[model samples]
Target chain A: MREDKKTPSVRKLRVRKSHIKTRLVLFLLLTAALMLTVIFAQQICPYDPNAQDTSISLQPPSLEHLAGTDRFGRDMFSRILVGLQTSVLSTLCLVVIITVAGTAAGILCGYYGGILDSVVMRISDVCLAFPGLVFALAIASLLGGGLHNAVFALAVISWPKYARIARSQTLSVKNTDYISAARLAGGNSIQIIIRHVLPNSIGPILVTSMLDIGTMLMELAGLSFLGLGAQPPTAELGNMMSGGRSMLQTYPWVIIGPGIAIFAAVVIFNLLGDTFRDYLDPRNSRRN
Target chain B: MEPILTADNLTKIFDEKGKEKFTAVDHISFQLYPGETLGIVGESGSGKSTLAKMISRLTDITEGNLFLCGKEITRVKGKALRRAYEDIQMVFQSPAASFDPRRTLGDGIGESLRNHGVSKVNVQKEAVRLLKECGLSPEFADRYPHEVSGGQCQRAAIARALAIRPKILICDEATSALDVTVQQQIMELLGRMREEREIACIFICHNLGLVQSFCDRLLVMYEGKIVEEGTPDEVIKNPRSDYTKELIEAVL
Candidate 1:
């Protein structure tokens, strides 16, 4: 009986150490790739994304333009690199806004939990009622098309999800023994929420934010496709695809180039998010 | 002896769904004189824990009052309410569940001192001292809840409750989750603390034998009411209430 117990515990310890190592490796690789992409964006791409050559318009893949020329004679590969920057930038902005706004709103509603909670949640419900695309389009139309406006539109629609998650987490954490202990020690409401509630609830919030980044990127691309995102000459993926679609049959590589960029970006973020969810979730970590 | 804490007709009622109103604590009254241990004993649904919660002000009284150091706590609000909290601290049943697993045990204990505006240096020193008193090494302060054993976690929780040096310490099934050996040690520790600090305590538990040894006085609760109250010797040797006798027999 003693050996049986000892063996399982030893195995569990090994598994836990390996899990931590896997997480560290994945985190480092993903962050390094993202950083490098941003740092060397301009140096790596040979063609100026905005500089068009009418003479080489509609040319197929060649040494001059590796991914070939678009209908406007702009190099598709260069524009795709610039498009990576725009997509990553917009998604980063959206995540920051959602993380800050959603977490704060969630903490307030969850900790206080009364008339204020009802009021805040009802507002979240109203926002959630609208389909994501419709909400984004409406906000973009109102704010007018630009990089900042796209980010604002995405953030406005995205915050409700984080708020709902944060609020639920806060409600559960506020009742924990640590919270009561804090209160009994003469810690006021603000002190209790900040010290006890937020730390416990942040793990889930972080996992959700990681997953939200992928969805935010997709939404930004969709909005740009509809002419509601980045304007012309801005070199966004959606705009590049839109500009390439007209001659897609003659030059398939034009759409293919930007399509690959979007696919890689989304897949990488989703994988990282899934890995993070597994690592940070207490239940999952405990099981391992 | 002057009472450090007293509950006069303390009651708490919860409005259940439909027309049913559940009385969790019904007109229960008791007193904990300085340096005395009053054990509130009952089964799971008997409201012993509810009574302890009221004494600690974890739950508000519905129709009665509580006094700490001669001040009425039922109507106390704002700064007065916060000030009242410093005199009373609670140790919960499941120490692991009570604390945030993300935080270190040291931070949890130091937070209590920090909240009352104690200096950072003093809070750390006191936290270390309390941990040591609870039979924990100072190194345990830097570890998260998951890193420690259940008994050690409970000890850490007790240290956190004692950090303020409150006049009253309320244990809501504090040792029930521990093994028999650990439970005995915890009971002995409480006895030692009561002797050294001269602090009043309300020990809430369902185990009659456990309280019989630890408590000076015992109050028997039944369905949210204090059916019987007296010294442990009197209550155990010559039980007056049928429910009290049955509870004692059932546990024995």
Candidate 2:
């Protein structure tokens, strides 16, 4: 009787585990595909992304150019491939910077929580109070237009979100018995934070960063659209789209190509982030 | 003979500057001699846990002097504080909660040994051995805290505390979260360890019956003060304080 009752639950658990595994595998494969495309983008492009040809300017999609030619006569398909490489890679770089910097600052602040914490958190509060894109625009304009400056500006604004998540997670984990046990086990502050605090608090931060990928991508593209990011001949998706904006009615292929690339990238990352959140949640992961 | 641990008028005020200042533990003092099980019992919110926290140095002592092995450790910080932990260890109320959810039970058990300079290879072996010693299977070392039953996790917690070979072990309601049968088993294990190692222990709990059987000396606390103190038999038989009588009556 007991075996009969337990068998269904065991089966349910197995089903759930497989479901999570498949989702995780799909997400990883898609992310890897994006990364690989970014890595081999230059090699894969049929024509130089920045090369100009007045003879083929404003040409429609055809056998020669898959995404047609922009007003500047740059092959839309080639520009998009390289442009994807730039946009995705830079977004990844920006995410890494903000996640690392924010998590570090937050852990230190949440753990120690005195003068340094107060100062740093207040600064983050100020950063968070403003509209994110507007603040980034202000900083980007101040720093002058470039891919690096745009990333820096976005990073300056976006990091607080991760910091807030990390700080709150840290604060909640700080008082748990495991942390106290680590302390009683003779672990120094650094050891305790690394072993006990960071691992426990990292779930929410990771989820936040995963979800932020889509947002960051859109924001980066937005900056480029506003003429505050990735300059001419850079082959960034946003820049490509921005350059083709004037010719959108006349040569819709140019704008649509980069638009589709951005849309696909955003959707993939958002779905990956959703799956990551589901997998990371302990309620769903309790194998016992 | 000197005491293994001493708390001189330990106090803990929750808020420093506020309209409402609450004293969780108020002017409490006690001493634990070597090779003795000192039981601290009180009703809920009587500051038994707070007193335990102060003695273990997990929570800051608002106003008091804590002397471990006759050295004043009222305000020690950093390296010195970590050094102090080698001599003093704690098993908290919830066994599962005390072990890091992300880490294996073996990792939590071996953590102290690793932190105190034990080699990586030896730490694993020692952790398995400790698990076995605590009445758990060697395989339990690899399991996460939530994977095991509460009793098994408490046994792992006990193993972790004993790993450091500390002179003083503070059990802050360590077995309160377990079932009666499991509690009895844990009590028996603790009794055997006390005889074998002669490790001084501060066992904090609210269960009067358990304290009577397990403790060598009992301190009955009420409103953060040690209202009564004696051998468990003496206190239960001839209670000096009204709170002690009330506690005994409540148990009956």
lDDT of 1 by residue, A45-88 (tens): 88898897898887888988888888778887788888889888
Please list the residue runs of candidate 1 whose C-alpha ends up more than 4 Å from where it truly belongs after superposition. A1-31, A281-288, B17-19
Interface RMSDs of the predictions, in order, are 1.5, 0.8
Model 2: per-residue lDDT, tens digit, B37-94?
9999999999999888888788899998999999988889888888888888888889
Clash list (residue pairs), candidate 2:
none
lDDT of 1: 0.84
Show the colliding residue pairs in model 1: A177-B98, A178-B98
Leading candidate by TM-score? 2
lDDT of 2 at B98: 91
Indicate the docking level reached by candidate 1. medium
Provide the lowest-lDDT 10-residue window in model 2 chain B. B16-25
TM-score of each model's B chain? 0.96, 0.97
